[model samples]
Target: MKENVFYGKGMGPVKKDYPDIYEAIVGLNDAVYTGKALDYKTQKLIALAIAASNSDDRAVKKQISSVVETFDTSKDEIMDVLRIVLLTSGMPPFVKAVNLLYEVID
Candidate 1:
């Protein structure tokens, strides 16, 4: 029932059961993806960073895979985001993200 937020697919029953919530979530996604202050790639990296900070493996992998596939995002650029996590979220989450990153990118 959980949608892949990146592709705008996989809404499952949410579209039929909770139309309002689904629309709001879709709207929020649109708002976040708008290129106002940060560019799209930068925003995606931040999203990956947030996933890392939360230690959410599914989200972390999804974001990582999406970035790698969608953009010409470099390994170093991905590391740059993880490096920020190392500073703010500390070693655990940073390590988790880095490990997952290797799995996804490799």
Candidate 2:
């Protein structure tokens, strides 16, 4: 399994220092990412939107990178997600997310 970029550096420390906790987190991720109702790509897009909505620049960039690398997610798909962020989260976060998206993709 690929390391979740959202977890960043903290995950390595947690996994090294607290193996049980890391495994629990990994289990939770496995459960949550199951493609039952929505496919993994859709789930990732939703996650990207959430990251954008929160104005989390690092998360936005990492999510974009991970999604694109893992799923070959297209720019248009990401733009659609960013559209939602624009409506629900306003211009600032949306702009930040768009900028980060370009940084990662282009």
Q: Write the residue-wise lDDT of candidate 1 on 1-106 in tens digits.
A: 2233544345757777888988887888887688789878888899899999999888998899888888868889999999999999999999999999999889
Global local distance difference test of model 1: 0.84
Best by lDDT: 2
TM-score of each: 0.86, 0.92
How does model 1 score by TM-score? Answer: 0.86
Model 1 residue 32 CA deviation (Å) reads 1.7
lDDT of each: 0.84, 0.87
In candidate 1 the C-alpha lDDT for residue 95 amounts to 93
Best by TM-score: 2
Model 2 lDDT per residue over 1-106, tens place: 3454435668888889999998898888888888889988888889889989999887888889889989888999999999999999899999999999889989
For candidate 2, the TM-score is 0.92
